[model samples]
Target: MSPTDLGPGGPATIGAAVAHHAAHIPDHPAIVCEGRTLTYQQLHRGANQAARALAAADARAGSRVAYLGVESEWYYELYVACARTGAVLVPINWRLTPPEIEHILRDSGAELLVASEDHLAALDGIRGDLPQLGAVVSLAGYESWRAGRDPADLPDTTDRQTPVVQLYTSGTTGLPKGVVLAQRSFFAVREALADAGLDWIDWQPDDVSLIGIPGFHVGGIWWASQGLVAGVTNVAMPFFDSSVAVGLIRGRGVTTMCVVPAMLRLILREPGVGKADFDQLRKVVYGGSPIASSLLTEAVEAMGASFAQIYGLTETGNTSICLPPADHQPGSPRLAAAGRPYPGFAAKIIDGDGGPVPPGTVGEVCLRTPARMLEYWGMPDATSATLVDGWIHTGDAGYLDEDGYLYICDRIKDMIIVAGEKIYPTEVENALIQHPAVAETAVVGVPDDRFGEAVHAFVALDPGAQATPRDLATFLKGRIATFKIPVRFTFLERIPRNPSGKILRRELRERFWTDRVRQVN
Candidate 1:
């Protein structure tokens, strides 16, 4: 392996430069959050102190530490502390139910849990069920614990290959799966970002980044790491609110921001949306789901040409595919594609037998990259199923054109079959989103006696716009083949989505076929 590959003393591990920046940029703003700002020196000291506390509590390297908090400066410090101590940081989604949270806490064998005051109540309800959880530290209580400790001499024992994070899958199907990402995986993502022309969005000493996505997701964790790695300032919001995001961008002169499609839609719909100058904004990275071409065009017009798109999953670090600013043209062919594979990442479509598919033939998208996850936590069977012959089966159905641009068709499991024809939900959803009345749409397969499975759509309309099921069906009838049109349409106030804004088709299907013997194939 090259020296650039993650190992001891490599630039990929947070410990590689933590002390360097802590001493050099001690006074530089490391994080700006909720009217309070922390300098690099403070962050370093805070993380060190937290590490000492964990050590004092018998937490050792490779130990699991569950972080149960919303976005906060303290949350970042805890993450860094885990990295410094060689502990696996497992971030729990605050949106999950108590039982769901309990399952992760137990399954990961987490001995330490750092939770916010709001989340503490939830933990209290399930504390008795988690015998393995040794300690529950509250963010609000950390200050008192560190009052007497000297943080400068805390022990640092991080190794480059050590697992840094265990991110749980969104679990739209069943229980969430834990994806283990090592320090090497993170370093690979940073290197890929630099190699993919995204270095221009690199953090500077004075740069403040507005983080709108939930810290539990990849967008928040990876982007936050990018800022920290460059010793730049990061401004975090506890939860997503369009007015607050707009205020931070304009008020704090935020130079960079990471957002999801729904967040962008909310920001664009804000009443004072057009009033914000956003002159300080340098780049707006959008991902998590396929972005509508129309939304991309409007975003460029609203936020300038700073919008960039990234495509990746938790199991593949954070970014493997990137559509750079140069590809954001009004009618560029690349806009329809998911851009090119990141440097050091090789992607291809494979058929049922695992043979490479020819260009333009839809199949499973497989990736081979340094940034791939170590394994699915405690799931050797699933891991073996996904990672075969050094390639990660992405389970996404897409084709690569002759130019090597990736055109994502849909999820392999989400393909709708109607009257012997295959219909991709993303295609139908993409076409539906173009309509002015539609805000969001999710397509799923529903039971039908004639057709083995029929295409069904659940839509959320734009504010003050009304459209019936027949109207939407008629709108799509001419755009696609007759077989591809949705057989049933349900107008909902809002579609159910996971924390990352990916629509929950499994939930939609369960409502109709939960009791039926024939569940989704």
Candidate 2:
């Protein structure tokens, strides 16, 4: 769709952003996947074709469109097309099982399901059960479906407040909640930066970006939007793989990328990883969970790349706080902080009573930002509890330092209250990782007759390494407090993590707490 093609106002939402760039810089590279590169002009026209096909299939304003596929050019095109109409997108996690996928499809009441070949095979048995699902469109048939559609004009059904993407939460504690984000959610940061003229947040037209994270998370789709808004070239990865990422960085002149700590750890473990060139790589942003300082230090020295730490939740739409590259020094106090709030964003620590706490006082982290999500789909009570008076209660326990940098402690529900003492698992896990033999560890509080609740740990050791409960206990004695050390340690082949690299502590706690009525002491 061209600027003249738009009835009146030209390109207001994300779908409009594509048309905006296409009209201004029609030939610039927009997306690169496999061996194909799509220019802005091609992206705009393809999205228009997709919009027509979707509308023909009974999709219109307020329709729910679900996509089950790996990261690809078509996935993004559908996103832009949905913006052309008022359809909301629910990008399903490809790693989910049939039952899980069914739950999301039913919950969202999705009318159209667009999937790749592999996902189609996985859902062959369960697609019949989805009564609300109207038609399933495969990427193989996308071109055929849009062959006769005209790209000159499209339906105008977009508003800044209209929901765009419905991102499901990581669900570490329970079933995933769908976070509904409006068109303003993705572009507020960009709009704010444009007004402030911040050099650190600026994106250059020549800079190449790599989107290696999974599409199910806000980070993946939101990160891709930045490149489009800047009219830069983006290389989309099917998923994050160590060897594949290394090859892309060295082979494609990749400059910027987003990753979680687990991906960084895997990248560090790959054979001959040090020999790989990172000269072209500039900045790497990581979030989704707390990272160990050891891993952070090692990554800094190995890649020689600037690192930025982001802190946010799906409910917030995007990162409210960012620890920029300058604050990621070896022993800087700010290294442990989640960094200050971004421009045009405000963050504060508040008590349980909903009153603000003084700096250095621990409480809940609350944020007010333009990127905040509109609501959790069909979850009115949850939305009411989370969003209060334009402030989002993050549900994570933390404190703002004197300099306003937020230091995340732990999830308030995940914190262990043992004999009136509070213990955060990340603190204990960080100490355990300091041991040479320990590769990964998860700390939880178990029922104990003596102390009411005793710390217990599930550990995964380094390859060919051995360690006993006594070894880790002794190792952690001086590193952390004695009460925080694990009383019992069980070795595991590997720790379970979500696609976004968040540890599922609830799964681990289920087996131990099944017979009991409650989880905590």
Candidate 3:
């Protein structure tokens, strides 16, 4: 089928899409997790039964349901069930505090929560605070609940434009906002993949995809959706473990995998990763943050030409710009760029005034696409501010080349100016990560009397590796401009990160600038 034909034409709801694919590939392995395998037909039946159970509990069309759990096979089934029932699925981040969970539940107006036993304990701490929470269902008990239900009674297809999921953004500035994604957005992304050369990955019905990222994040959800849409097998890992991931890749002959920079660092740190026979591993798609060029170069040399870099936001359906397999070359300009904008997306770098900027001028990257989120749930003001004139202002400072390749500078908020010179944290962080002792690093601007803001580095040492504050300070002095070198250094066991492996710069700034009144721009 052509790329255009993939857009929201076949199925009105996600359940319908699953059913359609299940009929075509009934006996195909749909999901494999923790030694449990579910075929396409079995997966459909399981989801149908789960939908019936939700329906029996009064989860009708338009109801909002929050799912609190780690990534697992049941998460996929529950998501499918919610899609079938036309209920808005909210997958809570497992790492969130009880207060944070309560806030998300209240903000999303989630009437019901389906949580695993472990995650349910967190809710007990703030159950009294969630006024919108009506009922709690234990996923551990789902099998018992489904045992008495008939799968044949599942709800039929509904409107495709209806909200299928409400993915909460990692709110660095304030409260998290739910990005309401519709069925059409998923279909648009599936179509966009085709334009980005989906065949280059050689996806097949027999291929097994290793899903190591959290299901709540857009990256994880996108990988899961890709498997579902293509009728490929998914080898699910509850959470990312480098040794376990390597074993799965080599043992199961997994064809494709998705990860972030931090996870890739861990995988590369594994002793046997490079030596392992990854015969069937054909692609490693990565994004969520800037990867160091040194790491990318080493990965390409070790893993062959299977590394693809994607640049996108949660609001844009997890893929708007992709560096194709052919472009995974050492010292390639495209590696510095976020690659070209995906098909069906029109992207431009615009100044603060929202007008297009010169080719090399850094500006806020704005995108107009059918895959953009419908709106930020319950925050019309924020939604209006972000989505203007049919374009979504990405709040990212970047530039586009003459050939339309996007070069991300940094988050507009995270950009540092020292003595009137602009410094992107990513640039500084990339340089710091290249140090042998630096396992991870985050660069932020701290208060400075002379320069207005001085660069500060938070460094995490590699296992069995050590470095002193002055050691890193002197090391960076030689590699970067004198003005860009960090004035202060803080050593940590590990850098703070969200579930998707993106660094929490806001958290770092909060701790370092607590005494100051103004924190960020």
Query: Which regions of candidate 1 deviate over 4 angstroms?
Result: 1-12, 153-155, 171-173, 193-201, 415-521
TM-score of each: 0.78, 0.78, 0.78
- In candidate 3, stretches whose alpha carbon ends up further than 4 angstroms from where it belongs are 1-12, 153-155, 193-202, 415-521
Please provide the root mean square deviation of candidate 2 (C-alpha atoms, Å): 11.0
lDDT of 1 by residue, 208-306 (tens): 788877778876888888777777778999878789988888889888888876677678878867735577777888777666566677788888737
Worst 10-residue stretch by lDDT in candidate 3? 1-10
Local accuracy by lDDT, each model: 0.76, 0.79, 0.76
Query: What residue pairs are clashing in model 3?
Result: none
| Number of the top lDDT candidate | 2
Judge candidate 1 at residue 329 and give its lDDT: 78
Q: Please give, for residues 150-248, the per-residue lDDT of candidate 3 as tens digits.
A: 766365666658888899874434356899988777667565666566643446656779886778887788778777766788888887788988888
Query: What are the clashing pairs of model 1?
Result: none
- Compared to the true structure, candidate 3 yields what TM-score? 0.78
